[model samples]
Target: MVFFGDSMLETLGRVVVFLLVVLVVLLASLLSLFFVMLRTKRILFPNFVLFIVSLLYEILCRLLSFFRVDPTLIDRVSVEMRNALNYTEFAATDPRERILLLPQCIRSIDCPARLDSLEGICCVECRGCAIGELSARSREIGIRMYISPGGTFTERILTRSKPKAVVGVSCYPNLYEGLLKAKLMGVPAQGVPLSAAGCVKTTVDCEEVMNKCKIRS
Candidate 1:
Protein backbone atom coordinates (compact mmCIF):
# COMPACT_ATOMS: atom_id res chain seq x y z
CA MET A 1 0.00 0.00 0.00
CA VAL A 2 2.77 2.43 0.88
CA PHE A 3 4.66 1.58 -2.32
CA PHE A 4 1.55 2.11 -4.40
CA GLY A 5 0.97 5.47 -2.75
CA ASP A 6 4.55 6.51 -3.43
CA SER A 7 4.28 5.47 -7.08
CA MET A 8 1.09 7.45 -7.53
CA LEU A 9 2.64 10.50 -5.91
CA GLU A 10 5.66 10.24 -8.20
CA THR A 11 3.42 10.03 -11.24
CA LEU A 12 1.49 13.05 -10.09
CA GLY A 13 4.72 14.96 -9.53
CA ARG A 14 5.90 14.14 -13.03
CA VAL A 15 2.60 15.26 -14.48
CA VAL A 16 2.86 18.56 -12.63
CA VAL A 17 6.38 19.10 -13.90
CA PHE A 18 5.33 18.35 -17.44
CA LEU A 19 2.45 20.78 -17.22
CA LEU A 20 4.74 23.51 -15.88
CA VAL A 21 7.18 22.94 -18.74
CA VAL A 22 4.38 23.15 -21.26
CA LEU A 23 3.12 26.37 -19.69
CA VAL A 24 6.61 27.88 -19.89
CA VAL A 25 6.93 26.86 -23.53
CA LEU A 26 3.57 28.42 -24.33
CA LEU A 27 4.61 31.68 -22.66
CA ALA A 28 7.87 31.70 -24.59
CA SER A 29 6.08 31.12 -27.86
CA LEU A 30 3.67 33.96 -27.16
CA LEU A 31 6.56 36.29 -26.37
CA SER A 32 8.37 35.29 -29.53
CA LEU A 33 5.24 35.83 -31.60
CA PHE A 34 4.73 39.24 -30.01
CA PHE A 35 8.29 40.19 -30.85
CA VAL A 36 7.81 39.10 -34.42
CA MET A 37 4.66 41.17 -34.62
CA LEU A 38 6.57 44.14 -33.26
CA ARG A 39 9.30 43.71 -35.84
CA THR A 40 6.71 43.49 -38.61
CA LYS A 41 4.72 46.45 -37.17
CA ARG A 42 1.58 44.39 -37.15
CA ILE A 43 0.39 45.37 -33.64
CA LEU A 44 1.05 48.25 -31.33
CA PHE A 45 2.86 47.80 -28.01
CA PRO A 46 -0.29 48.46 -25.98
CA ASN A 47 -2.12 45.67 -27.72
CA PHE A 48 0.89 43.39 -27.39
CA VAL A 49 1.10 44.09 -23.67
CA LEU A 50 -2.57 43.34 -23.24
CA PHE A 51 -2.16 40.06 -25.08
CA ILE A 52 0.83 39.09 -22.98
CA VAL A 53 -1.06 39.84 -19.78
CA SER A 54 -4.03 37.81 -20.87
CA LEU A 55 -1.80 34.93 -21.84
CA LEU A 56 -0.01 35.07 -18.51
CA TYR A 57 -3.27 34.93 -16.66
CA GLU A 58 -4.38 31.93 -18.66
CA ILE A 59 -1.05 30.22 -18.11
CA LEU A 60 -1.18 30.88 -14.39
CA CYS A 61 -4.59 29.32 -14.22
CA ARG A 62 -3.41 26.30 -16.18
CA LEU A 63 -0.39 25.91 -13.93
CA LEU A 64 -2.55 26.06 -10.86
CA SER A 65 -4.72 23.28 -12.20
CA PHE A 66 -1.61 21.24 -13.00
CA PHE A 67 -0.60 21.26 -9.34
CA ARG A 68 -4.16 20.48 -8.27
CA VAL A 69 -4.13 23.84 -6.53
CA ASP A 70 -7.21 24.95 -8.43
CA PRO A 71 -9.18 22.87 -10.90
CA THR A 72 -11.76 25.59 -11.43
CA LEU A 73 -9.53 27.49 -13.83
CA ILE A 74 -9.71 24.67 -16.35
CA ASP A 75 -13.44 25.16 -16.47
CA ARG A 76 -12.83 28.91 -16.69
CA VAL A 77 -10.70 28.40 -19.79
CA SER A 78 -13.53 26.45 -21.39
CA VAL A 79 -15.98 29.17 -20.52
CA GLU A 80 -13.67 31.84 -21.86
CA MET A 81 -13.22 29.92 -25.09
CA ARG A 82 -16.96 29.63 -25.44
CA ASN A 83 -17.36 33.35 -24.83
CA ALA A 84 -14.68 34.12 -27.40
CA LEU A 85 -16.52 31.98 -29.90
CA ASN A 86 -19.61 34.11 -29.32
CA TYR A 87 -17.66 37.18 -30.42
CA THR A 88 -17.17 35.89 -33.98
CA GLU A 89 -19.64 36.65 -36.78
CA PHE A 90 -20.76 34.36 -39.59
CA ALA A 91 -21.59 35.43 -43.14
CA ALA A 92 -25.32 34.97 -43.66
CA THR A 93 -28.67 34.01 -42.26
CA ASP A 94 -29.50 32.13 -45.45
CA PRO A 95 -28.13 28.88 -43.97
CA ARG A 96 -25.69 28.38 -46.81
CA GLU A 97 -22.76 30.57 -45.82
CA ARG A 98 -19.47 28.68 -45.80
CA ILE A 99 -17.49 28.40 -42.58
CA LEU A 100 -14.21 26.52 -42.86
CA LEU A 101 -12.55 24.40 -40.18
CA LEU A 102 -8.98 23.64 -41.18
CA PRO A 103 -6.80 21.18 -39.32
CA GLN A 104 -3.05 21.79 -39.28
CA CYS A 105 -1.88 18.21 -39.77
CA ILE A 106 -3.80 15.42 -41.42
CA ARG A 107 -3.48 11.70 -41.87
CA SER A 108 -2.01 10.57 -45.16
CA ILE A 109 -3.61 7.93 -47.39
CA ASP A 110 -0.42 5.88 -47.83
CA CYS A 111 0.80 6.14 -44.25
CA PRO A 112 0.91 3.36 -41.64
CA ALA A 113 -2.36 2.07 -40.17
CA ARG A 114 -2.22 4.35 -37.14
CA LEU A 115 -1.20 7.36 -39.19
CA ASP A 116 -3.58 6.53 -42.04
CA SER A 117 -6.55 7.80 -40.07
CA LEU A 118 -4.77 10.92 -38.91
CA GLU A 119 -5.55 12.58 -42.25
CA GLY A 120 -8.63 14.78 -42.09
CA ILE A 121 -10.49 12.74 -44.73
CA CYS A 122 -10.99 9.78 -42.42
CA CYS A 123 -12.68 11.78 -39.66
CA VAL A 124 -14.10 8.69 -38.08
CA GLU A 125 -16.79 9.81 -35.64
CA CYS A 126 -14.53 8.91 -32.74
CA ARG A 127 -15.29 12.24 -30.96
CA GLY A 128 -11.63 12.38 -29.88
CA CYS A 129 -11.62 16.17 -30.19
CA ALA A 130 -13.80 19.27 -30.54
CA ILE A 131 -14.21 18.90 -34.33
CA GLY A 132 -17.33 16.80 -33.95
CA GLU A 133 -18.90 19.33 -31.64
CA LEU A 134 -17.98 22.25 -33.92
CA SER A 135 -19.40 20.37 -36.93
CA ALA A 136 -22.63 19.71 -35.11
CA ARG A 137 -22.92 23.33 -34.08
CA SER A 138 -22.25 24.52 -37.62
CA ARG A 139 -25.05 22.30 -38.84
CA GLU A 140 -27.36 23.58 -36.14
CA ILE A 141 -26.60 27.15 -37.12
CA GLY A 142 -27.24 26.36 -40.82
CA ILE A 143 -23.65 27.13 -41.74
CA ARG A 144 -21.50 24.86 -43.86
CA MET A 145 -18.32 23.74 -42.11
CA TYR A 146 -15.72 21.90 -44.16
CA ILE A 147 -12.90 19.90 -42.65
CA SER A 148 -10.18 21.15 -44.97
CA PRO A 149 -6.84 19.35 -44.55
CA GLY A 150 -4.72 21.61 -46.70
CA GLY A 151 -4.45 25.06 -48.29
CA THR A 152 -5.61 23.80 -51.70
CA PHE A 153 -8.82 22.37 -50.31
CA THR A 154 -9.42 25.51 -48.26
CA GLU A 155 -9.04 27.74 -51.29
CA ARG A 156 -11.28 25.43 -53.29
CA ILE A 157 -14.00 25.73 -50.67
CA LEU A 158 -13.70 29.52 -50.75
CA THR A 159 -13.82 29.61 -54.54
CA ARG A 160 -16.90 27.43 -54.57
CA SER A 161 -18.88 29.10 -51.79
CA LYS A 162 -18.03 32.75 -52.28
CA PRO A 163 -19.28 33.39 -48.78
CA LYS A 164 -19.81 36.97 -47.68
CA ALA A 165 -17.92 36.25 -44.48
CA VAL A 166 -15.81 33.41 -43.05
CA VAL A 167 -15.03 31.96 -39.65
CA GLY A 168 -11.86 29.97 -40.10
CA VAL A 169 -9.88 27.71 -37.78
CA SER A 170 -6.13 27.48 -38.39
CA CYS A 171 -2.67 28.37 -37.13
CA TYR A 172 -1.12 31.82 -37.31
CA PRO A 173 0.29 31.50 -40.81
CA ASN A 174 -2.90 30.12 -42.30
CA LEU A 175 -4.96 32.65 -40.42
CA TYR A 176 -2.84 35.46 -41.85
CA GLU A 177 -3.17 34.03 -45.35
CA GLY A 178 -6.92 33.61 -45.02
CA LEU A 179 -7.28 37.14 -43.69
CA LEU A 180 -5.28 38.49 -46.61
CA LYS A 181 -7.39 36.59 -49.09
CA ALA A 182 -10.58 37.79 -47.47
CA LYS A 183 -9.38 41.37 -47.56
CA LEU A 184 -8.40 41.15 -51.22
CA MET A 185 -11.78 39.67 -52.07
CA GLY A 186 -13.79 42.03 -49.80
CA VAL A 187 -15.00 39.22 -47.57
CA PRO A 188 -15.25 39.71 -43.82
CA ALA A 189 -13.32 37.02 -41.96
CA GLN A 190 -12.71 35.90 -38.41
CA GLY A 191 -10.07 33.35 -37.40
CA VAL A 192 -9.68 31.15 -34.32
CA PRO A 193 -6.18 29.78 -33.93
CA LEU A 194 -5.62 26.31 -32.47
CA SER A 195 -3.68 25.95 -29.25
CA ALA A 196 -1.14 23.30 -28.17
CA ALA A 197 -3.70 20.81 -26.86
CA GLY A 198 -3.08 18.44 -29.83
CA CYS A 199 -6.83 18.48 -30.26
CA VAL A 200 -6.62 19.65 -33.83
CA LYS A 201 -10.36 20.06 -33.83
CA THR A 202 -11.87 23.22 -32.32
CA THR A 203 -14.63 24.21 -29.94
CA VAL A 204 -16.94 27.00 -31.03
CA ASP A 205 -19.93 28.35 -29.13
CA CYS A 206 -22.89 29.31 -31.32
CA GLU A 207 -24.15 31.82 -28.82
CA GLU A 208 -20.93 33.74 -29.26
CA VAL A 209 -21.35 33.95 -32.99
CA MET A 210 -24.96 34.95 -32.61
CA ASN A 211 -24.00 37.64 -30.17
CA LYS A 212 -21.47 38.96 -32.61
CA CYS A 213 -24.09 39.11 -35.30
CA LYS A 214 -26.51 40.83 -32.89
CA ILE A 215 -29.18 38.29 -33.77
CA ARG A 216 -32.41 38.62 -31.84
CA SER A 217 -33.51 36.18 -29.16
Candidate 2:
Protein backbone atom coordinates (compact mmCIF):
# COMPACT_ATOMS: atom_id res chain seq x y z
CA MET A 1 0.00 0.00 0.00
CA VAL A 2 2.80 2.43 0.90
CA PHE A 3 4.71 1.71 -2.31
CA PHE A 4 1.61 2.23 -4.43
CA GLY A 5 0.86 5.53 -2.73
CA ASP A 6 4.47 6.73 -3.19
CA SER A 7 4.39 5.83 -6.90
CA MET A 8 1.16 7.74 -7.45
CA LEU A 9 2.51 10.81 -5.66
CA GLU A 10 5.70 10.74 -7.70
CA THR A 11 3.74 10.49 -10.96
CA LEU A 12 1.52 13.40 -9.96
CA GLY A 13 4.51 15.52 -9.05
CA ARG A 14 6.17 14.81 -12.37
CA VAL A 15 3.02 15.73 -14.26
CA VAL A 16 2.67 18.99 -12.33
CA VAL A 17 6.31 19.90 -13.00
CA PHE A 18 5.91 19.15 -16.68
CA LEU A 19 2.84 21.38 -16.92
CA LEU A 20 4.62 24.22 -15.13
CA VAL A 21 7.60 23.98 -17.47
CA VAL A 22 5.29 24.06 -20.50
CA LEU A 23 3.50 27.11 -19.14
CA VAL A 24 6.74 29.00 -18.60
CA VAL A 25 7.96 28.12 -22.07
CA LEU A 26 4.77 29.29 -23.72
CA LEU A 27 4.76 32.56 -21.79
CA ALA A 28 8.39 33.26 -22.59
CA SER A 29 7.89 32.51 -26.26
CA LEU A 30 4.88 34.87 -26.44
CA LEU A 31 6.73 37.69 -24.68
CA SER A 32 9.68 37.41 -27.04
CA LEU A 33 7.44 37.46 -30.07
CA PHE A 34 5.40 40.35 -28.69
CA PHE A 35 8.40 42.60 -28.10
CA VAL A 36 10.00 41.74 -31.39
CA MET A 37 6.82 42.51 -33.29
CA LEU A 38 6.31 45.72 -31.39
CA ARG A 39 9.79 47.02 -32.09
CA THR A 40 9.83 46.11 -35.78
CA LYS A 41 6.17 46.81 -36.49
CA ARG A 42 6.28 43.41 -38.15
CA ILE A 43 5.45 39.87 -37.24
CA LEU A 44 7.92 37.03 -36.95
CA PHE A 45 6.86 33.42 -37.31
CA PRO A 46 3.30 34.63 -37.45
CA ASN A 47 1.75 31.14 -37.46
CA PHE A 48 3.71 30.09 -34.38
CA VAL A 49 2.99 33.35 -32.59
CA LEU A 50 -0.68 33.11 -33.42
CA PHE A 51 -0.91 29.57 -32.04
CA ILE A 52 0.77 30.60 -28.80
CA VAL A 53 -1.47 33.64 -28.48
CA SER A 54 -4.58 31.57 -28.98
CA LEU A 55 -3.43 28.96 -26.50
CA LEU A 56 -2.35 31.35 -23.77
CA TYR A 57 -4.60 34.32 -24.52
CA GLU A 58 -6.42 34.65 -21.18
CA ILE A 59 -3.46 33.73 -19.00
CA LEU A 60 -1.17 36.02 -20.98
CA CYS A 61 -3.55 38.95 -20.61
CA ARG A 62 -3.94 38.28 -16.88
CA LEU A 63 -0.19 38.14 -16.44
CA LEU A 64 0.18 41.44 -18.28
CA SER A 65 -2.39 42.99 -15.94
CA PHE A 66 -0.63 41.63 -12.88
CA PHE A 67 2.61 43.18 -14.13
CA ARG A 68 0.87 46.54 -14.76
CA VAL A 69 1.15 46.21 -18.54
CA ASP A 70 -1.82 46.99 -20.75
CA PRO A 71 -3.89 43.81 -21.17
CA THR A 72 -5.05 44.96 -24.58
CA LEU A 73 -1.49 44.75 -25.83
CA ILE A 74 -1.85 41.05 -26.55
CA ASP A 75 -5.08 41.64 -28.42
CA ARG A 76 -3.48 44.35 -30.53
CA VAL A 77 -0.54 42.11 -31.36
CA SER A 78 -2.82 39.23 -32.29
CA VAL A 79 -4.94 41.46 -34.54
CA GLU A 80 -1.88 42.77 -36.36
CA MET A 81 -0.49 39.27 -36.70
CA ARG A 82 -3.70 38.08 -38.28
CA ASN A 83 -3.82 41.04 -40.63
CA ALA A 84 -0.30 40.44 -41.92
CA LEU A 85 -0.79 36.72 -42.22
CA ASN A 86 -4.09 37.02 -44.06
CA TYR A 87 -3.22 39.97 -46.27
CA THR A 88 -2.35 37.96 -49.37
CA GLU A 89 -5.50 35.87 -49.41
CA PHE A 90 -7.66 38.78 -48.36
CA ALA A 91 -6.30 41.02 -51.08
CA ALA A 92 -6.81 38.33 -53.69
CA THR A 93 -10.50 37.95 -52.91
CA ASP A 94 -12.89 39.79 -55.20
CA PRO A 95 -14.36 43.03 -53.93
CA ARG A 96 -17.80 41.85 -54.95
CA GLU A 97 -17.31 38.83 -52.67
CA ARG A 98 -16.02 40.92 -49.79
CA ILE A 99 -17.77 42.59 -46.87
CA LEU A 100 -16.76 45.64 -44.86
CA LEU A 101 -18.14 45.45 -41.32
CA LEU A 102 -18.29 48.50 -39.11
CA PRO A 103 -19.25 48.80 -35.49
CA GLN A 104 -22.39 50.81 -34.70
CA CYS A 105 -20.63 52.93 -32.06
CA ILE A 106 -18.76 54.81 -34.82
CA ARG A 107 -22.02 56.30 -35.99
CA SER A 108 -23.24 59.71 -34.96
CA ILE A 109 -25.23 59.84 -31.72
CA ASP A 110 -28.39 60.96 -33.53
CA CYS A 111 -27.94 58.62 -36.48
CA PRO A 112 -31.17 57.04 -37.70
CA ALA A 113 -30.02 53.66 -39.01
CA ARG A 114 -32.37 50.78 -38.24
CA LEU A 115 -31.59 47.11 -37.53
CA ASP A 116 -32.57 44.29 -39.86
CA SER A 117 -32.58 40.57 -39.08
CA LEU A 118 -30.31 39.67 -42.00
CA GLU A 119 -28.36 42.90 -42.44
CA GLY A 120 -27.45 44.29 -39.04
CA ILE A 121 -28.06 48.03 -39.53
CA CYS A 122 -29.56 49.56 -42.65
CA CYS A 123 -27.49 52.60 -43.60
CA VAL A 124 -29.76 55.19 -45.26
CA GLU A 125 -26.84 57.40 -46.33
CA CYS A 126 -28.41 60.31 -44.39
CA ARG A 127 -24.91 61.77 -44.36
CA GLY A 128 -25.04 61.41 -40.60
CA CYS A 129 -21.41 60.28 -40.45
CA ALA A 130 -18.52 58.75 -42.40
CA ILE A 131 -20.56 55.61 -42.93
CA GLY A 132 -22.57 57.47 -45.54
CA GLU A 133 -19.49 58.44 -47.49
CA LEU A 134 -17.90 55.04 -46.97
CA SER A 135 -21.12 53.43 -48.09
CA ALA A 136 -21.02 55.38 -51.32
CA ARG A 137 -17.41 54.44 -52.02
CA SER A 138 -17.98 50.78 -51.14
CA ARG A 139 -20.99 50.70 -53.45
CA GLU A 140 -18.92 52.20 -56.20
CA ILE A 141 -16.35 49.43 -55.83
CA GLY A 142 -19.06 46.70 -55.72
CA ILE A 143 -18.36 45.70 -52.12
CA ARG A 144 -21.04 45.10 -49.52
CA MET A 145 -21.04 46.96 -46.20
CA TYR A 146 -22.76 46.03 -42.96
CA ILE A 147 -22.93 48.09 -39.78
CA SER A 148 -23.03 45.50 -37.06
CA PRO A 149 -25.18 46.40 -34.06
CA GLY A 150 -23.00 44.21 -31.84
CA GLY A 151 -20.46 41.41 -31.88
CA THR A 152 -22.98 38.61 -32.20
CA PHE A 153 -24.44 40.05 -35.37
CA THR A 154 -21.11 39.63 -37.17
CA GLU A 155 -21.50 35.88 -37.59
CA ARG A 156 -25.05 36.32 -38.81
CA ILE A 157 -24.06 38.85 -41.44
CA LEU A 158 -21.15 36.69 -42.58
CA THR A 159 -23.34 33.62 -42.83
CA ARG A 160 -26.01 35.39 -44.86
CA SER A 161 -23.66 37.31 -47.10
CA LYS A 162 -21.21 34.42 -47.59
CA PRO A 163 -18.33 36.80 -48.12
CA LYS A 164 -15.00 35.56 -49.43
CA ALA A 165 -13.15 38.16 -47.38
CA VAL A 166 -13.91 40.69 -44.67
CA VAL A 167 -12.45 44.01 -43.52
CA GLY A 168 -13.62 44.63 -39.95
CA VAL A 169 -13.24 47.90 -38.02
CA SER A 170 -13.49 47.81 -34.24
CA CYS A 171 -11.58 48.08 -30.98
CA TYR A 172 -8.57 45.80 -30.49
CA PRO A 173 -10.27 43.18 -28.34
CA ASN A 174 -13.24 42.87 -30.64
CA LEU A 175 -10.97 42.86 -33.69
CA TYR A 176 -8.92 40.06 -32.15
CA GLU A 177 -11.94 37.85 -31.53
CA GLY A 178 -13.57 38.85 -34.80
CA LEU A 179 -10.49 37.98 -36.83
CA LEU A 180 -10.09 34.67 -35.03
CA LYS A 181 -13.74 33.81 -35.60
CA ALA A 182 -13.49 34.70 -39.27
CA LYS A 183 -10.35 32.59 -39.61
CA LEU A 184 -12.15 29.63 -38.04
CA MET A 185 -15.00 30.13 -40.48
CA GLY A 186 -12.42 29.84 -43.32
CA VAL A 187 -12.85 33.49 -44.27
CA PRO A 188 -9.82 35.74 -44.68
CA ALA A 189 -10.04 39.03 -42.79
CA GLN A 190 -8.26 42.32 -42.14
CA GLY A 191 -8.77 44.42 -39.02
CA VAL A 192 -8.67 48.21 -38.73
CA PRO A 193 -8.45 49.43 -35.16
CA LEU A 194 -10.54 52.38 -34.03
CA SER A 195 -8.67 55.64 -33.48
CA ALA A 196 -10.82 56.29 -30.42
CA ALA A 197 -12.45 53.29 -28.82
CA GLY A 198 -15.54 53.44 -26.65
CA CYS A 199 -19.03 52.04 -26.26
CA VAL A 200 -20.54 55.28 -27.58
CA LYS A 201 -19.36 57.81 -30.15
CA THR A 202 -16.25 55.86 -31.09
CA THR A 203 -14.16 57.09 -34.01
CA VAL A 204 -12.35 55.09 -36.70
CA ASP A 205 -9.71 56.13 -39.22
CA CYS A 206 -11.90 56.27 -42.26
CA GLU A 207 -8.95 56.60 -44.64
CA GLU A 208 -7.17 53.60 -43.20
CA VAL A 209 -10.32 51.50 -43.40
CA MET A 210 -10.96 52.56 -46.97
CA ASN A 211 -7.39 51.69 -47.84
CA LYS A 212 -7.86 48.22 -46.43
CA CYS A 213 -11.17 47.87 -48.23
CA LYS A 214 -9.54 48.62 -51.58
CA ILE A 215 -6.60 46.23 -51.21
CA ARG A 216 -6.30 44.04 -54.32
CA SER A 217 -4.13 41.23 -55.57
lDDT of each: 0.51, 0.91
TM per prediction: 0.44, 0.95
Clashes of each: 5, 0
**lDDT of candidate 1?**
0.51
Best model per TM-score: 2
Off by over 4 Å in 1: 1-96, 104-124, 197-217
Number of clashing residue pairs, candidate 2: 0
Highest lDDT among the candidates is held by which one?
A: 2
Question: Candidate 1 at 99: error in angstroms?
Answer: 1.7
TM-score of 1: 0.44
| Candidate 2 least-lDDT 10 residues | 1-10
lDDT of 1 by residue, 82-200 (tens): 32332334323344455545463432233232322223343443445555555566666676666665647656667677775666665444554555565456665666555532333
Q: With candidate 1 superimposed using the best TM-score fit, by how many Å does residue 123's alpha carbon deviate from the native?
A: 4.0
lDDT of 2 by residue, 1-217 (tens): 3566878999999999999999999898889889888998877898988898898889999999999999999999889889999999998998888999999988898999888877889999998887898899999989899999885799988887899999999999999999999999999999999999999888887889889999998
Error of 1 at 155 (Å): 1.5
What TM-score should be assigned to candidate 2? Answer: 0.95
